[model samples]
Target: MTVPHRLSRRTFVGGALLGASALTGCSTVSRSTDVAAINKPAELPVYRRWKGAEPDLPTVNPLVPDAYLRYPRTTERAYSRKPGDGSEVKGSVAINTPIPPPPDRNRYWQELNARTNLNLGLTITPHADHTDKFQTQVAGDALGDIWTIPDRTPYLPQLLEAKAQDLTPYLSGRAILKYPFLASIPTDSWRGCVFSGRIFALPVPRGALSALALLVRADLFRERGVDPEFSTVDELMSVARSMSDDRNNRWAFASVPTSILCTMMGISNDWAEHGGKLTYFKETEEWLEVLDISRRMVREKLAHPDGITSYNGKAWFQSGAVSMMQDTYSALAGLYQQAKGDFEIGLPIVPGPDGAPAKPWYLNPNNAITGVSRAAPERIEMLLDFLNWCSAPIGTDEYTFRKYGIEGIHHTVKDGDPRMTAVGNSETGLGDFPIQYLTESPKPLYLPGFPDGTKEMYRNLKAVTPGMKPGPVHGLYSPTSSKKGELLGKFIDDTTNDVLLGRAKVSAWPETVRRWRRRGGDAMRAEYEQALEVKAG
Candidate 1:
């Protein structure tokens, strides 16, 4: 399945995520955020790993997912009974994959309903169309029994506070331990669900798995005799220059490596967190330096000559037109498949200017979060049970069924691993119907029939996650950010792009940033800083 952009601010925490202990110590220094008047850490779910199939490989970093070389031949029953109420359940969720076969004609859908004892119906919104669909519904107050809330929706915190159920009473602390699969989700992931001091949704955990990484061509590095171990930005750029050849119409980058450059420069993940204060990255001198470096890369032909216009960076990376591109760790599977033995991919950690291990900006630790609209306690409980059942981890009969579909009809084991059958390719899959977006287990480092890729991904995550940091303002509400939303966001984005593309002088940045601050950036910063001061637990 296609992944949404990793660095996009659009990736969101649940409207309100976590108690004090829920968020891991990253850039944010707000344990008090989870205290009473803000939230209660005791209200959060206790983390308990699901006892499932043993992994063939080890994951030292807790953020890195366990890797499996072979699919578990057997699955244990996670629950003894169906989670649904034998009644129709309707919901809406966004999908990045192609629309799957509809429930009426799909065997997998028919079986899922029978197994769950619910007539499940969902209006699947394509990622491209989701914003409009979600907003239209939100405006009309017509949210279904369940829905996936977009991170960028206008006044998200208010909408959730007004229309969504407070999941804290159900999922908080030891209370969550009853839902084995939900408890299995890392506690930090639940931090994304906290809004206004209460849990409002169930997060879709991606954690460090979704962090953006620099994908370099290892074969080319060896062939060109370029050293792959560089600890500073200048050293890395030297290598980039050595790897590029304008005369041959080749560059070291497919597109402007903005995200990678920002990481290397130690720019904070949107907002920099310091002693009881939060500073937006746009207000910093370091971000401007990154913009200048990006512009220089364009002028020196280190990046593609098209000047950052819409172009396929992955296509360039695959075709050898570019030696490096930035993508999430999840991209390796597709890259390996497309390469067809043509190249070896490398995951190199970029170091900061001071040679410190640069902190990669972690996505919200979740994608969209699933929220339940106001409903009877029984209906809500049933929905939660259904979600917890959906979270059945790898090596459970439910995970196997929901993730891959029925064995013979959808997938088959071949050469010691599961492979999708031709029928599985067209009639069923997550891209076609994104039930997983509602809530699924944290993804394992598993790619059917690509064991090496799985191993490599694990190594990659291990290499970088120790230095990764999350955006401090992620779950904190900023009324200015919500009210103005992307309208105000577009101004800053356009200004930043103009400077990066060399259309505007680097000196213009200060004025542009000032304009941003004057418009709403300053207010957002104030709001977030205030949020950090409030206690949660």
Candidate 2:
């Protein structure tokens, strides 16, 4: 089915309004660009001009606004009636599934559909295995109007380049800014969606404070009289050595492979600055010191003997065998819920060789940007409207009921906090309800069964976590990501992993850098440079 490329100006204008609504009330605005016009309320005359198919103006002014300029309404119409009843506004939408919904049945898709005003029929696809599925569908012209393409996949750049609707107009204005919680999304998350100054995706902003941290057993630390707050790597190692008793079926700290360790230590594979260059980790002594310390930790037996074999680091922490491991803060809630004893989980800011706290690794800001398919243009407005609604803060009672389910059915409020009880269970043994995944409001610090002081413990952990220095690859989004950059990405990942794991020595890093440059890295750099040039213009 060869889809016709209409290139209709109205479609482009309408899509622009929809995209703009998604970002309207978001918290962080990009200072890098001039978005003044987008920050204001929609002028009514402009709305009248762009309203559906009727041109009120005699001639289209290049600068004049249209009906598409109206404040975006919520798209919750789909949830107004039962699925397949067709009582709501009757537009069909294709979306990616299994779709995430509020745990409560009453407010789930019903709220989503009512806000978006569309019947969203989802096409089930896994994020990991969707590349070929997406390609085949797009090539066949069988794509849904709204689908989520994973940010991690290689196919995103290509999809955007192939005439996908540019969402820049929609995202730039007051329509999106009206929703207060929607305003909280960070601009960095939207950077990946911008190409040639046009936006194509609605970014799902991961919170700014995300970072990898060490999770340790509070029970074990208390028993051993260890303070659990080590000022230096040496102090941490000292505790690990004393606590590790692998012979008695205990290990002080579970060993993480080199790549994660290096990231925790802040060793980026490449660094760029001043719009001119790229540098490798081999050029820095800090990189070598991090590796040397890690190798010694393994040799000294402070880490698990089978550390290399223990790939599931979370499971190690969960089983109570490995007392300490590193992971993101998102894991904190689950780990606290699952651990048997009253244990505290703390995030020690990774320490440098000088025993001073080092900067935590900052992930690429665009980590969670999402794209909608071009197959269904009408669906775009609905999708963005629903997203904006979801980003709003819920009342405390509403938040608990929506996230945990009814008080007696799925959970019980104990001591003024909701506790997980009987209702549903999955293969993971815990119920499928996810209280922590809500992006609308900042997650509450309380959870049932955690020690009374756990909230304070988390506050203290965050207080100690170090700030991030700008990444070497900061502000660089690859435009050549269209060409051979996919191969280059794989090489970088593979070579970096090899060097970190000690499978390839530090001496091999320079050659690895050269190999990467030879295999499209240089070209990709050039592409980004060009993009920056255009953006500057």
Candidate 3:
């Protein structure tokens, strides 16, 4: 629904911690409540995998992506007809990477335009600046042909209704089969593109690849004869305590992992559905218990004192100052790339308290989506077709070219793997540009040279499928939430931190939550409930 502006590209790969209420978005000028329905597309675009090389590993859930260890030697094209109308396609995207060389100096950029048969006139904005950039454009109704947003706006449904294309007619049900690659996107992901009971965006699917997790330094844990496996939260805490050695300047965690702790204790990620009504997670008993649990951990000195302040969790994890930190599953590749030969990364399962099964929160099927501004029907078709061509799956020539570029020019092949050369990394800026956010294929459990890590990633992904839980409010829009959600979210997060570090007592959290409810939380619940009711009817 929305991308967090503060997260790095690595964080985006795994999933950004966009807080709880950052769901659907649109405009500032309020419109009538005619755009009130909350249902997703009725008949989703049916999934049909592109014919490609078979995955080396067995597929997990159909929801989980197939895994590949080696690149396909031979590839086929997905489009018989060219996507472009032999004209320029104007677009923009936000990135955490450095500004890349433009098409004139960047051969990779030039080739993409040439192959797609469209000259791309694009504007790139740093993620920090993207919120303002997008808002300015949205407010002006000047969004280019293609644009991806940074955060949920107050009136996303109204925004689209007024300025963006209504995609329901084009993408709903079997209508999308015309664009094979776009239709290949799973049904759950297609749901994210819906707002006001209509489709308004194209998904950038990540599936469960972005599930939040606790990462432990397996090499260190192994040295102490402790496997990072536990059947109970108590067992995990015991190990965390043993790993903390004040004299050695090592702690158990980089920070208090609220999401993991909440999962372990059975706290819902957003509103917990009750019959037909909804209750905000902060108002629940589980939240109170998790607050106490987190406070206890903080008091035990199991985390860095600076964890919430100036500390850099990634730097500390790399230096072994902390044995564990919370992150997304997609971080596995970067960890492998960094560990090299020094240490191994472990995904420690956060089992329930006293060994009850934990229903860990999973990310929405898509991280963020690309929306199109209003355009003539034919021009819109051209843009959609171009995105379809761009969305080619991993085993195709278009995919290979966009990701790694030509063998000698941008990358080198070694030991059955494609390696990006320095020139490729520099000119393409694949790691930095966040191009995938614009349009992407189903994610693969992939690590180019580290096939072993690829296998491990697959194993962990398959292992977590049974208990993964998605948010109830994923595709629904909440006017009060979008209007004041950020402010209220900050209030709760800051209060939680205060309690965790002894600045506020656990006894005060209920009162803090009560204040939150009055300030907008309660209003949000009513809005969501009303929307849900309208949808059901």
Q: Give the top-scoring candidate (TM-score).
A: 3
Q: What tens digits encode model 1's per-residue C-alpha lDDT throughout 1-537?
A: 011254233222232232223333333232332222333223568898877888888758678787887787666877788999899898888887667778888888888999899998888888888877887776566778889976566545445666788888899988887788999888777876786567888988877777778889888889899876677767778988998998997899877777777778778577788886877776788888778888777788887775365667888888888898888776776676456564888877677667765677685678668889978888989999999998998888888788667888888878767666767766565323477889989888877666766766777677667856567765555555655545656677777667766689888888987888888777767766776666321
- Model 2 alpha-carbon drift over 4 Å, by segment: 1-120, 124-143, 161-164, 257-276, 305-310, 352-356, 365-367, 374-379, 394-402, 424-475, 479-509, 520-537
Residues 355-380 of candidate 3 have per-residue lDDT tens digits of: 65465566465667788877788988
**TM-score between candidate 1 and the true structure:** 0.88
How should the candidates be ordered by TM-score, best one leading? 3, 1, 2
Clashes of 3: 5
2 or 3, greater by lDDT: 3
Q: If both were scored by TM-score, which would come out higher, candidate 2 or candidate 3?
A: 3
Model 2 lDDT, residue 50, Cα: 15
Who is ahead in lDDT, 1 or 3? 1
CA lDDT of each prediction against the hidden true structure? 0.73, 0.46, 0.71
Better of 1 and 3 by TM-score: 3
Task: Give me candidate 3's TM-score against the actual structure.
Answer: 0.90
- Best candidate (score: lDDT): 1
Cα RMSD to the true fold for all candidates: 6.2, 13.1, 4.9
